[model samples]
Target: MNPTIQLEQQYLVHAYNRAPFVFTDGEGVWLQDDAGNRYLDLVAGIAVNALGYGDAELVQVMQAAASKPLHYSNLYHSQPMAQLAARLVQVTPFAERIHFQNSGTECNEAAIKFARKWARSHFGEGKTDIIAFSGAFHGRTMGALAATPRPKYQDPFRPLMPGVRLAEFNDPDSLAATIDDHVCAVIVEPVQGEGGIHPATPAFMSALRELCHRHNALLILDEVQCGVGRTGTFWAHETYGIMPDILCAAKPLAAGLPIGAVLTSGRVAEAIHPGDHGTTFAGGPFVTAVANVVVERVSQPAFLRHVSETGAYFQEKLQEINSPHIIEVRGKGLMLGVQLDMPTAPIIQAGYQHGLLLLNAGADVLRLIPPLIISRDEVDIAVERLTAILTKSA
Candidate 1:
């Protein structure tokens, strides 16, 4: 066995099935393992590294912040947190207030609490249930895990939270039927990331918004993996033209820094009192400062337009490969997936051997969430490598 792998197995908890190779460093679109082998990084730390690895600006900011104050309690106001909140509100359509968390799961927890609080305050204790989509993945915490509808993830931890119902995504009738007066919120992903790169239909999103309004339920969009310019927009819901009442953002928000947030409308913000919810590491200065820089860079109109053009070009190139194993290509902007007729494990392994890194969503969907700053040349390289692997695997 490899020395590093041996050491890791001895010390680390066996929670994740990590790849064999241990990456030593990364720069731009390239990553180098310990043996000096280079691979094109299409996964981008599972869609967290927005500006790619070794971003000088982010490095400088993080280093400077580290030297000063690493972390402080949320009781005291921090400039970075205040600045990031302001920046998020200024860039996004519905960002009345921001509640920070350490990870996407924690952010979802905060959203769930806020939604329930809003419901209880407006419609009494009866309105406490939350409707989540069938293929949605909020997070792994208890509350967020309950919102996640996958049996594989929830079976062991059965009897999660009560009043949580699952509705088929992109199906307006299913969602409408599940939501009622008791449904405090309907949490969904604009583009379902882990449940396969499934983009929500515009009609469905519009209808969901209307339905939420009718039943006085809040609409929460979890953009943990697809937000922050990954889908060529500041917010994935922007493409659907329907604003959510509460939006959860994380992943690339801070360009690989640990940060998560819940952006809510003024109404939802006002509903939650100070004592209702809180986090110690929430809205730390260092992470928020880094996030402020990332937000400003990603929210540029011209940059977003470029992302759209690049995504179209990338998809066109992918289609040109014409691999028989590929069943369909779906998704928007940089967040795409190739649905394979066969299992994706062999193909992903083959891609790894051919100096490419990829991720899988479900059994057959090959997720492609590269850095938003990836260029056409890098896209071409990734496509070539992936096509070769797909051809061989097929």
Candidate 2:
């Protein structure tokens, strides 16, 4: 075993099933382990490293931000934080304000609070229930955990936050039956990342929006893994052609740094005031400085076009693979899921020997979310490596 892995096992809590090797460095879409072996990274830090490792502009921004004081808390005003909020609101069509958190989970927790607060402020009492769908992975925190319906993640943490109702994913009838006047919000992922990279259909999204409005409930889009140009659009919901009352984003925002943002419409923003929700380390100078550059670069028209073109090319190449183990290829842009007839654990382990880094959305779905900056050549390489992996796995 690697010395670092041994040390971590001894000292840290036994929670995560981590890879054995230690990554010493990374550049673009490739990562180098401590043994100096290079691997093509398709996971991209679980969709967090959108610009990839060692980005020039991101490095420069980090250097500049590090030279100054790192944290002043959220007590005082910050230029980077303010500027990042402005940039986010400007890019997001329905957002009028932004609230920063430390990760995707925190953003979802804050969104739930805001929804309940908004409902209470407007509808008085009893409108506090939240509707979530099956196969949704919002976050691990108490409030967000309640909405994520998987038995594996929820069973251990029983007696979760009350009033969280569950409906079937992509099923409008289930949603319509589940939602009622008592519901305050309906939270869902535009693209289900951890739940096997399932992209919500347009009809489902539209119906969700219409139902939320009809029942006076807030529509919260959890874009933690799909937003910020991951789906060839600035926001994943953009493809659905409907606006959300509250949108939660994180992961790729700071290009690998821990950060989360809750973008809200004016109506939702009005309900949140001083002391409704607060975070001490959120929206600090250091992280927001890097996030500003990420937002600016990823929001570019040319960059988004690259994601769209390469994503289509990638999907095409995956479908062309002659492996009989392959069942389907789904998802959008850089975020894709390859459903296999067999488990993906062995395939993921085999990728290491093939000089390829891989991730699995579930037992049988291989998730591919390479860096947004990955070129066509890199995509071809990934596809070729994946073909070999799938063939051998079968």
Candidate 3:
């Protein structure tokens, strides 16, 4: 066994089932293991390393922020936080306010709280139910977890918060049946990330918007893994042409730095007064400064165009592989899934051996969330390695 892996096992909690390899460093689309073996990082740290590893610009920003102060309480205003909030509101359509958090879970938690508060103030306490879809993953926190519908993630911690309903993703009938006047909000992912990279159909999203509006319920979109140019657009919901009342984003927002944000429409923004919710590390100057840079680069039209082109190229190549083991190929932009006839664990192991890193969304789907900035050559390399692994496994 590698010395680093041994050391990690000795000290760290056994919560994660990590790969055997220990990565020492990375640059662009490649990660170097402790033994000096390099692999193409198609997973991109589970889509958090948006600019790829060792991004000089992001590193410099972190260093500069480090030189000054590390963190400050949310009570105080910071230039970076202000700037990032302004930039986010400006770039996203219909978003007027921003509340920062430290992770995607925290952002979702805030959104849930905001929804309840908005509902209670306008309608009453009874109108606090939140409708979330099956196979959704919001976060581990009690509030966010309550909004997540998967039984496996929630069964262990039974008696989650009340008034949380589960609807079917991309099924308007299920949503319409569950969401009603009592429901405060309906949260969904434009493209389900951990749920096998399933893109929500246009009609489904459009119906959700109408239903939410008609019922006076806020619509929240969890774009933690699919946003930040991963879906060839700044936000995955943009493809559906539906704007969410509350948007939760994180993961790659800061290109690996821990930062999350909840952007709310003007109507929802007006509902939450000061002190309704707060986080100690929300919008810390250092993290927000890095996020500003990431947002600037990712929101560029040219960069997003490149993401679209590369994503189309990636899907095309994956389809061309046409292996019998491949059950289906689906997704948008760099956020894709190759659903296999067999469990994805062995294929992932094979990919690791073939100098490639990938992610398993569930039992049967291999998720490909490469960096939006990945070059054409890198995509081709990833596809070739994946094809070889799939062929051998079949």
The sequence of per-residue lDDT tens digits that candidate 3 reaches over residues 176-199 is 899889999999999998988899
TM-score of each: 0.98, 0.99, 0.98
> What is the lDDT, from 0 to 100, of the residue 300 in candidate 1?
93
lDDT of 2 by residue, 1-394 (tens): 8899899999999999997799999999999999999999999999999999898889998999999999999889999999999999999999999999999999999999999999999999999999999899998889999999988998999989999999999999999999999999999999999999999988899999999989999999999999999999999999888999999999999999999999999999999999989989999999999999999999999999999999999999999999999999999999999999999899999999989999999899999999898999998898888888887774
Write the number of the candidate with greater TM-score, choosing between 1 and 2.
2
Model 1 is weakest, by summed lDDT over 10 consecutive residues, at: 385-394
lDDT by candidate, in order shown = 0.89, 0.94, 0.90
10 residues in a row with least lDDT, candidate 2: 385-394
Which residue pairs overlap in candidate 1's backbone?
none
In candidate 1, residue 303 scores what lDDT?
A: 80
For model 1, what is the error of residue 55's alpha carbon versus the real structure, in angstroms, after optimal superposition? 1.1
